[model samples]
Target: MDAPALDLPFDAEAMLPGLRRWVECESPTFDAVAVGRMMEVAARDLALMGARIETVPGRMGYGPCVRASFPHPRAGAEPGVLVMGHLDTVHPTGTLPALPWRREGDRLYGPGVYDMKGGNWIAVEAIRQLQRAGVATKRPVTVLLTSDEEVGSPSTRDLIEAEAARHAVVLVPEPARPDGGVVTGRYAIARFNLRATGRPSHAGARLADGRSAIREMCRQVVAIEAMTTDAATYSVGVIRGGQWVNCVATHCDAESLSMAKRQADLDEAVERMLALRSATDGVSLEVQRGVTRPVWEPDGKVMALYETARGIARSIGFDITSQSSGGGSDGNFTGAMGIPTLDGLGVQGAGGHTLEEHLLVSSLVPRAKLMAGLLQVA
Candidate 1:
């Protein structure tokens, strides 16, 4: 069945109001109540453009995943392109004052504006444009928005992979680089927690009898830090233990960050971590977590998708460039599934996860137009 052609006018500026509203609403990870409100707004906006919206349940106290779709014009065509983004931000309920839309010349300041509430709006506007122009795409279209991305997408990773496998290509609307280049490759992230145990004793009286868990932890930390090489990086981020100044610490826990360029590096790191035994005979060790996201290498299929995206950008008078990043995203999950994924298709800005996070207002319209054009061509 041919879907009805849409002729709705899509103004990039027209999306700013809604985008700012979304940014102002604090939808932090696992805040199911707040996230539900945000999803309601998105579903309303998408419905106006003739989209069917459904919420995919999530586990582990994560926000819901939304799937909005517009059927293809012709029956028995190829599957659709999936325009993906997330609704969650790193900010809690009120980490900083929720900055509304502020235009200082050509920049818009707000939380998750560029890092990616703005990107979601861009995708919606693009689809609206294609429908309004009466363009009959050869495939169906789906936009999957998750609410757990800022927190590593613990719950929606499976849903994302499934959607990506069903699509022709996955376009991630993460914020572009400050230089306006798209991202073609992203690193995998593996976050782990390490714990050590020791007997407690009075520091002044029985210091010799008590084994220091902190000391054992320090040895393991030094060993892990030493494993960092050019291809991979590791950091002992947090350490917490000890009861009193005059007492030998009975327990110590530490968290580490591990990055790898390839899967083998991750496996080696995990093996090393699991092999960690207490340096002191009296102490014990535990490895709590392991690899979270796999590395995303851009193979030939991914490169071809990027080439097509670059052509779409060129048609809209935007010269797009690609680069590799050590940071991970949902794109990493999709790319690891052997699906062609391209990221950084949103506004270009910097200061992510900080107070200064802002988006270039000038880039918003052009990028939106480019994305809209890509949907038309795809």
Candidate 2:
């Protein structure tokens, strides 16, 4: 397939070198040091673009967030565009060796490539292209590269909301939809911590004397999985318990996540999940709530922004559609807060949060042009 005739100067081949650097950085969310390194790499690129950079120190043991404000005629005057993205990925530090950065046909494979690093780079490149051509944007542009999004924006939720409130619209460069669509709405997501406690005893000598917390937790997991329905789904992805095989486990813990199409349904799911009790007589269960992303149902303002982006896509020769994605992103915060937010404005790709993660090489230029056009007009 050939790219549509667009006037933008963005070139996919030209973007590869820098994009490779970003993908190779391997900034996983849980590793603050790795994430910090990724921030530095992005900072250097933003600085080279003549953007005024601010490094907001990371709180709660996460890495710092990079906020780059591009020079504009209406600099810091009114609410402008906030292009938000996360530099972190779900892959751990050693993932690079297994999923090494390489190109296969039209795909660029690497750790965090399709999940977000590629999108973050695209945001910067959009600004770079505009600056290179001396094209002035209608509003000020601020790119906020956050450290956490894969594990929920725990350290950056307040920052994302605060910065977004000061902007007229938020554009998130999460991986684009398989159908080449942008995101206008996102589902509500809730995280939970579950703990089970029970009496411990020697497994070999007194198995019946012990009340195993792991056993109770196993029951809880089954029950939690059974709670899934068409409106909302529940999952327990992480679980830890037991010190040794010779002793009955005294305590067990599990992490859960739930997503819903609507806020009300999510609230109901949350209540139900929290209400769980230990099935065994001597065991006790506890459920603690974690960070949440409110349901971002698209409103008139959001739809209007989508209309503008759709028109821009048409000008570039290919039409674009908008979607309400099941996954969550920073757009959930901004869109839910009534700010006009557009998401999935990144490279076309598939296989996010997996070893097979990759992005279409052909999507770089068009997506960058789309981002640049939005920076100019939206």
Candidate 3:
């Protein structure tokens, strides 16, 4: 495999300022006000590259999603490529005080630097490079930055899928693997909240008369845990019950996280959950199941996209490999829409969803170059 020719004139200095501006803006998902401000910034930056930008408002605490695009200069070339990322961070307001970004040698440390802000900036820089170099492609490019990706994209999945269906390719800038590989497939996730209610009685006076909802909850937990198999995994992440140590418990609830490789596996898990019956007679159970996101299966289109990405990476003096991850991202939605999607194109780093999250500063230029090349090819 030969390296792709790099024709774009990359401006590292220009990208630095844009990255700083984006990172400084607090775009936490739960903070609609702050996220709105961040979207404004993104819109402003994107406008400079002649992208037509639009903001879609979200409900309640959810922030707005920004959709921006730069059409191909030539008409009727090919279906455009859609670059997907999120503007919101998991950190809430005041978290910046604790996760202040620092430059230690070649690493950049901050709350959302590696998790995605850095990747977002890279996408912007890549577009800038393409515009500056006057690279003409038959395919146009659209960037979709949402506000609720970290929290499972509950409100943005529909928008993502709809947009993805209109494109020939979807590029996700989620943080790449620590070893700098792309993510081809990701596991599917299903979350359930189970509540059991039973009659309450005095523990000392009428122990037999009162049904134990807590005990029934334990039985359900065991049954759910038993569903975990080689291809699927389940966890009882949270459990709550009992008013006091002495009082008879009348209510109980448990939250479980389930992961599956296929739809059949997920169906099996859900069926098992639905089959659960109260251990004690007269006790009632209620279950609320929610699917946070669907799995990104590795199909023919995805495999072809990976090959293109690998060729582009090699063109930039790097070798690229891809693997299926148990983790999910916005790419899952795009892939489910039958679009060829490639993810994990951001700077290499580790420790997402933690205080130690960081990015390797050296990766910025090469990754941006790779993206610029991809845009040219698209």
Instruction: Pick the TM-score winner.
Output: 2
Task: Write the residue-wise lDDT of candidate 1 on 279-355 in tens digits.
Answer: 79899999877438888889898888778778767765678888877777899998888887888998877777777
Q: All candidates' lDDT scores?
A: 0.80, 0.90, 0.82
Ten-residue region with minimum lDDT total, candidate 3: 1-10
Q: What's the residue-level lDDT of 51 in candidate 2? A: 85
Candidate 2's displacement at residue 73, Å, is 1.5
Q: Can you give the TM-score per candidate against the true fold? A: 0.87, 0.97, 0.86
Ranking by TM-score: 2, 1, 3
What is the C-alpha lDDT profile of model 3 across 1-378, one tens digit per residue?
Answer: 223327566655556677877777877888988999999999998988888889899875788889997866652365688889998887777777787777788777777888799998998888887677666644788899999887678788888888888788888889988789988888887788899998898898888888888999998888888878988888787899999766678999998878888867877777777677787896898888865667778898789888888888887789888988777789888787678888998878776777777888888887888777777775
User: Model 2, 83-109: lDDT tens per residue?
Assistant: 999999999999989999999999999
The per-prediction tally of clashing pairs is 4, 0, 2
Candidate 3: lDDT of 179? 85
After best superposition, candidate 1 residue 254: deviation in angstroms? 3.2
Off by over 4 Å in 2: 1-6
Report how far off residue 86 is in candidate 3 (Å).
1.6
Position 327, candidate 1: lDDT: 71
| Root-mean-square deviation of every model | 3.7, 2.3, 3.3
